[model samples]
Target chain A: MSRLLIVDDDRVGVSALAALLEDDGYQVVALTSSAGGLEALSAGGFDAVITDLEMPGLHGLELVRAIRECSPTLPILIVTGYTNSPAAATAVAYGARRVFPKPVPYEDLLAELGAALPH
Target chain B: MPADDLERVYRWGWLPLIGGCVAVTAAMLAASELLFIHYGFADPTRLQRVLHLVRGAVMSFALALFAGWYMLRLRQRVEAARESLRAQQAAFARRAWKTEQAVGLGALCRLLVHEISDPINGLSLHCRLLERAAGRMEPTDAEPVRRIAAQLRDDTERLQGLAASYVEGNRAPGSSERYQDLSLEEIVRAAVAAHPCPEGVEIVVEAASDLAPVHAEPDRLRQLVEYLLRNAIDPPAGSHRVRVSMTNDGNRVLLAVADDGAGFEDPASVFRPFYPASSLRASLGLAIVRDVAREHGGDTRAANREGGGALLSVRLPMGERTS
Candidate 1:
């Protein structure tokens, strides 16, 4: 079972996504704070990181940058309300593997996570 | 260039006027001296002759001084007028910018809707996932759990409806237009014809002879072309000539309209869809152009040409104008 870290400022959004991902049989640790999300990733066992683009502090792009510096090979997927926005492109540039717009289709996110993971 | 011309004039253009003034003053003095000597008004004494010469010289000096003072005043007035004109232009630009923002309050509403849409959609998705999770719980499907699940489903539907209303209200242009292969040049010609250029406003259209057809809706494309034409030929910035061009680069059909006017304060500003006031209609038109072009599997390019003025163009893939 691949372990994943889900980070978003939306409390319910994070839990809801977490619950579904857990039900799908993946080990998940979800947080509504970027600070905690960073610390969790730094603890060193997660296979992937999913983060929101627009958050109060440490925007998704910065988060991706920080995570990438520590774990160069980890799969990082960015989810954003603002798709096609420059920030989304910047997040990718910062080493995020993919960007999914809000209300992201669950199947697509799963497929992306599966593909981005190490075989 | 205008400033350079003004500076050139200030440098040497006043020489002729000063020369003319000197000639007139000299002629007057000579005539007066001739009259004084010819009329024998002064006694034939050395002192009297000397005094008469001195008086003529004083009067001549005063005349030259007056001419110089008048010319100085004229130059000052011209400078003052030019300064005033510059101030008015600056004030007008500020006011126009404010007006563009005012007319674009519509864009603000659209932005708000977009912002609202994201959260609402996220909420709706969360609910759906929650609903799915709730259904799979074998022994956990108790009465309260079932009620909670039902409530989540209803709330999810409500949130989705709310989001749809906002999206439907603020839908981007040409969202519902039908598409088919159409000659872009034909649409350009019709749009140019529909909007007759004002007198003194010259409009020129250029198209490649073998331009390929683009997959686009004729009516919607016409509307987009008309907006571009109106924005170009009849801009509030004031232009004498506008150029409308259409061509194909093997894969995409490119269409553009350019005007010889004050280009965007920032070339990038032309494509930014939202900015505070000036040329309300022009901003609105360009916004539609951007939205429509994006719908057609392409995008807009707003730029200041190498020569001058702004060029707004949309490039649509010839084979696939829709994504």
Candidate 2:
């Protein structure tokens, strides 16, 4: 099983996505803060990082940049409500693998994880 | 060009005025000579005296004609200059009014986007969670809950689409509607370079180095690439890498953005304005992308890649006009 880290400032959203992903059969660790996400990321063992673009501290793009420095090939997916902004593109340039807008489809998320965490 | 036209009018005005005066002077001198010949039959002394009076009258008439011609020429020049000034002032006023309207509209859009974005995002997030919970329930119980969640999601997305339209439509009053020749490769490369890319996500550009340029609005095209790239690599879509390429067919240039990520379940719904199931529906990003393409007399389409993932392409007509 592949290990994935999910981060979002919205507690409800983080938990819900975690539950959904867990049901899809991945080893999921969900956190409501970027600080916690970063800590978990630094400890290693995560196959991929999934995060919300808009967050309280260490925003999505910033976290992606930080993660890029450590794991050059780790898959980073950004979930955002504001997909139209320049920040979306900036997130990708900073090393995010992809950006999924809010209310992501379950199957698509699964497929992306499958590709990213291919054992 | 207007100035040149006015200059031509001035030339025509002066040429006629000067020519008419010279003709009048010649006619007057001829008439004086005819009168002098007719008076030769009079007594010698009376005729001499008559000649003296005629000379004075002719001199006065000549002077008066010269003064009238000079005054009329001065008036004509003044009128032309005044008209030119008025035209310039009117143009300046129009420009100022357009600037004011654009600034006001820009402020309104910013304020509205700021106020409404957070609440809508929150609502959509919760609604998704509700739908997810509803899915795990008994079939009989889940149906209504799922229906309501779906309804709520639809409504929330409609509002989101409206907000996006407002932002896109809030163009400045005098924004350029003109198209210019643009290199697709340059724009795509720039946008890709600017976006933050995480590991395992590589953007492979497959454009021919000498591909033909497309006629397009540069800023809008840049936005289109940004939106497409974001959607292609978005984690839920499941592609770890993306390929952006360009080609030409007939009179248009085709820009294709493809991802090895999970492809769309329904390719046709991608461009619909408020369909939530489609990945591009969140902010109606795909709709706007399609609209932009259409505005340029072009078209956009989405399709499932044969192996996996998705392919989104836009066709922009070649611009023939030089800016």
Candidate 3:
């Protein structure tokens, strides 16, 4: 089973995204804080990581950078409601494989994630 | 002259008068010597008398000039002091204005974040619920369920984008891009759906069937609509009716939002930063609206509608610029 890690400041959003991913046959581990996410990563493994762009403690971009430093091959996707052209460009520049706007289309997200992960 | 004036003049004249008196006394002494020539004192020398007269004249003139110079210097000092005070007062006013703008902007940001958070939070909850349901459902049942979750996420992301744009426009180093081809009616409806008007207030939108699409940022366009709706809903007990109408004026698109509520005295001032006319405690909404319009290479204006209430109009260029 492909294990997925979801990080979001909003409990509801994390839970919702996790549910959808889980339904798609991925083992989902959802966390609401960057600290918890880092801890999870240190403890062991996740096939893919989905994170919200903006959060209170550690932002999505920083988390991605950190994950890349530890595991260069880890695929990180940023989900955000900040879908302006500039914001999107910034997210892409920050090492995010893909950026999905909030209330993202579930199928689209899943497809993108599937594509991002190595076979 | 009045007593005070006389005293000032006397104080100034005293030095000159004393010099004059000393001159007169010296002249008298020379004459006495001339008269006493037979009593062994040589006749006062012509050169001596001439020198004495010259000395007295020079001394009196110097006294008069010194006094005048002193008075002029005093006046200059007083003027300098006044100018310094005026400059300080101006500086203080400028600082106060800057501080006020900062506070107002901060409050506006807080309000905006608070408002935006609601939808984001809701979307988050829905996503979690959907996720939980997908966990227990069979593969066949979960497919459709998963699709709904994805759509919800997409919508929420759009909402976040709109909110972020609104906040970004209000900050420094604002975005420079002009308007683009976008659906004005759709953006307005989205804003309304994102933040529905108060329960009592009724919002009605009317647009020309063939209204040309406007060239503007979709997020900013939504912000303009939200601002108008917020203003319309902020009045005391009254028949709350907000009418939003759009028209294509050849090369430009005009959107008008009119409300039948407590009208404004000078609607022009509503666009001013921290405008105090409306009963709204914080006037950032109007400021934001005006900023968003200007950012899109457009303009926004507000006015008191005929009979009663206030009306706000936003104008933008339609289609691409040929030039």
Candidate 4:
């Protein structure tokens, strides 16, 4: 199974997403904060990361920037509440593979994730 | 619009007209007198010259008085025109202020809706998960559980659509390229079918034959039709029946929706967005209808029906529209 790291401040949302991903046969590591996410990524063997936009300590873009600097080729995807806002475009510019608006459309997310990592 | 400017015009505007008139009159009199005396038309006597001077002064005063009076009347007319223009300017300013307030509220609602939609989305996604989990189980009531999840998901989607309709209602009407040639009657029929009738309420939709198609934004138009139907079917006092009629009047499409419900206490207040929070839904529905009508180069009106219900009408240009 390919491993995935999902980060979000919304614990319920993160848990629900993690459950869904896990059911799809992915090894999911869920975090409710981005504070120690960088250190976690440094020791990571994850195939991809799925993150939410607004979070305490580090927002979506800042985390994307950090991750890009550390692992340039790691597939990064963002899910945000503000897709119409510049956050989505900016996330793509900062090396996020794509940004999905919440509540995450699971089918699309799954399709994108499937394309990002081999099953 | 300054009172002082009018005051100044009244005080000084006529000085040149009257003064010039008087001067020309006086000069003409003196020249005639000199010419007559030099040509021997009259004797060069002191009494004659004094009489001529007195006559000239009287004529000058008469002419100046007449000219000043006429100018004062003309000035009054100008003042009237200015006052009318000032009233129009004030009215326009008031409308602009209202529009600005609506726009500000729209921006706030847009952000608020996005914030709200996220949670609604989550709730909906949870429903999806519930359905998926039920799929793997062989429980006796599995179908019912799936049905409940499906309803919850559908309701959440409806809530999102309602919020979006309200947010769009608060927006300014301007150019938009997303429009299609659609039948007004067809849209009304679809709305009627989609919107559930309130308990004890029956809805009847009537359309004139051979109704022409209109260029419109179908989604917004459908929302408007649904909102109208919703309002008519459900009121505090309950409604027995509702009737929606559509017709083509020359180059425009006309829609009238009438409901036998608790009639509007204030028909004018129905469309205002800044009502008590309790009436926010009604306000939102009406505002959406109003703005959507305007965006399509149409208008909406509300009135208390003569036989006891409320009557609402919408008229739209049958020509092509950008939005």
Q: By descending TM-score, how would the candidates be arranged?
A: 4, 1, 2, 3
Give the per-residue lDDT digits (tens) of candidate 2, residues B126-243: 6877887898899999999999999998998898888767766765454444356788888999989987776789899988655788776676677677778877766566678899
TM for every model, in the order presented, reads: 0.44, 0.43, 0.40, 0.54
DockQ metric for all predictions: 0.11, 0.07, 0.07, 0.13
Give lDDT per model, in order: 0.71, 0.72, 0.69, 0.75
Put down candidate 4 lDDT per residue, A1-119, tens digits, no spaces.
Answer: 99999988777778888888898899999998876566678898989999876654455666888899988999999887655333455568778998886767789999999999865
Q: Per model, state how many residue pairs clash.
A: 8, 24, 25, 0
What is residue B12's positional error in candidate 4, in angstroms? 1.5
Number of the candidate with higher DockQ, 3 or 4: 4
For candidate 1, what is the DockQ? Answer: 0.11
Chain B TM-score of candidate 3 stands at 0.44
Worst 10 residues of 4 chain B by lDDT: B272-281
lDDT of model number 3: 0.69
For candidate 3, write residues A1-119 as lDDT tens digits: 88999988777667766776676689999998887898999887798888775554454555776888888887878776554433344456656788776556567788888898766
Q: Model 4: DockQ against the native?
A: 0.13
| Candidate 4 docking band | incorrect
Candidate 3 chain A worst ten-residue window by lDDT: A82-91
